[model samples]
Target: MTQIAALRVKKPDAPSSAGLLASLRGVSKAYATPAGSFMALQNIDLDIASGRFIAIVGKSGSGKTTLANLLTGIDSATSGSIRIGGVALEQKSEEELTAWRGRNVGVVFQFFQLLPTLTVVENVMLPMDFCRIGQTRDRRPRAMSLLAQLGIAEQADKLPSDLSGGQQQRAAIARALANDPQILVADEPTGNLDSHTTLEVMELFRSLTREGRTVVMVTHERDLGAFFTETVELADGQIVAIHNGEARP
Candidate 1:
């Protein structure tokens, strides 16, 4: 096994073998253009099992990001239903969805979105502040602990600009984990990384699954497919195939 930092957060009770962490039924998304409505997703159904590393892969304009947005409650669907951890997303108002997402989902982006003015530890603590998850004094300690878990404790006092790309990304991941969300939704997380760093980050994400967290990532990198437990392929706003990721030796 690769040497990846372990996540020691208190995990929820493990679900049954057949448990579904997220589900979508008849989901579709469309945006209005000058010509007409451009459909991004069309009548999609998906079930994401708990503790799985799921990859959504497809060419550009395949609705990969749109699907990721729907899963994270960052965007609403035009039609159909989405449930994550048994909470209906479509029914929630924008305010409700924001609160629900803060507690239930953590989103990772391609670029490290850390605030340049804040130290790495402060960046990690921001989510706790926004969500009011812990005491003010306790937040920094928890942030430091999360940074340590990600093997970036020494960088906690430094601003994101002072860290390397990999270190910055690690800080971002630590920040995402601050609230202990059930699911981590990453949109092309490795897009800005070099190949070596990408592999390291992918392994770190894989380890999160072992700690009983589901990870849903959107990527077009087929070479990195081996790290995912399952792959959902889409094309022309529709699911083309679903299959197990290739096993790595």
Candidate 2:
């Protein structure tokens, strides 16, 4: 069966949870520039519950990506706190944060940053190799299964350069899921895709949420807001509005 069809079959039975998987409390990010300290985000508080689909929307320089980086531990907050899955992310050392993020947060980037020389399955397996997620005997099969789950199993043997843009993106998603992470963070994931491909990828994200993964995506596309259960709008480094218990505008 196709990935979409499989998702449809299993979605109804997926688990659900209350409360949050990650939260930001008075979080802010600032960088020192030639002029002075420039704040990219300010006094932000947000909660992302397990299995929720959230979209952070804003124009350029609105601090959407900065917020994502903080959540994923790529960058530290200038002040305030960030908690992920009940653990304080800011408390961990860089080494610990790296390992923790690999096991807990799966990240997808806009450009589908797959290794050009590696075959599709190899790219998916790379995360497992770095994180040492599963036993040596199990990694390949697990990667294959994940690729199959994303409906790209047939492309497993091909290099990333040989696949279509959408296929490469799907492979990247499969790589992100290699460790079965609880939270998925995406930065402008559909930015480089055509409308049809964007829909396909968004549908895949919906499927992931149905499987009880928390998905937080940053985008400027207001038309795609309906896909999210929560919408957080940012302007000038601050959260301007939050809409919950509703579809996108």
Candidate 3:
């Protein structure tokens, strides 16, 4: 038998054969302008399984951010369907979406958008406070644990300005994971860091997937593709190609 066939035979059956944590079907987004409607994305169809590490890559104006925004419910789609964890986000009210996003998705931005006055641990705890994820007494411990997981526990008491760029980014990631979200959406997460720091952060993301969290990152850096299990290429506001750990042409 072929190696691929043998491997498939040896694999265990999944608890659920649905094989998807989130999906977008024929999705499109457009913005109104003086001249006409500007389409940012068109007929996007994607399926992301649980625990998968996915990277969406494209140049500026490629609609990578728009796709991420739609997936995370940061913005509404102009049309089509977005289903997350079997819940159709497109139909939810704004308040419902906010609560759903807080419980289901964790977001990391390019800029380490931490408060200047707050300490690292405090900043991490703030998300839980906003989302009301857990009891007030447990929030600090949870934040500390997340920081420790990212190898930034020692810097928890320091201010964002006091830490190095990489450390601050780690803190931001810790904050994003504060609510133990099922999905993590990051936009250019390592864009500001040096090569070494980028590697460190990428490793952390890889580990998170091992713990069964789905991760979707938007990046222009092709070098970072190695860290992901799958890569989706976007161009002209549409998916151009998908690669599963294969060498790019």
TM-scores across all candidates? 0.91, 0.90, 0.90
**Per-residue lDDT over 75-185 for candidate 2, one digit per residue giving the tens place of the 0 to 100 score:** 889899888778898899999999998887778999999999899999999989999876988988998998898898999999999998899889999998888776678
Per-residue alpha-carbon lDDT of candidate 1 for residues 184-224, written as tens digits (9 for 90 to 100) = 88999999999999988999998788877767888988788
Provide the lDDT at 224 for model 2: 83
| Clash pairs for candidate 1 | none
Model 2: worst 10 consecutive residues (lDDT sum): 1-10
Residue 128 accuracy (lDDT) in model 3: 88
Model 2, backbone clash pairs (residues 3+ apart or across chains), number? 1
For 52-113, candidate 3 gives per-residue lDDT tens digits of 67888877888999999998899999899988778999899999999998877789998989
Q: Is candidate 1 or candidate 3 better by TM-score?
A: 1
| Model 1 TM-score on a 0 to 1 scale | 0.91
What is residue 227's positional error in candidate 3, in angstroms?
1.4
List clashing residue pairs in candidate 2. Answer: 225-248
Per-structure clash totals for the candidates? 0, 1, 0
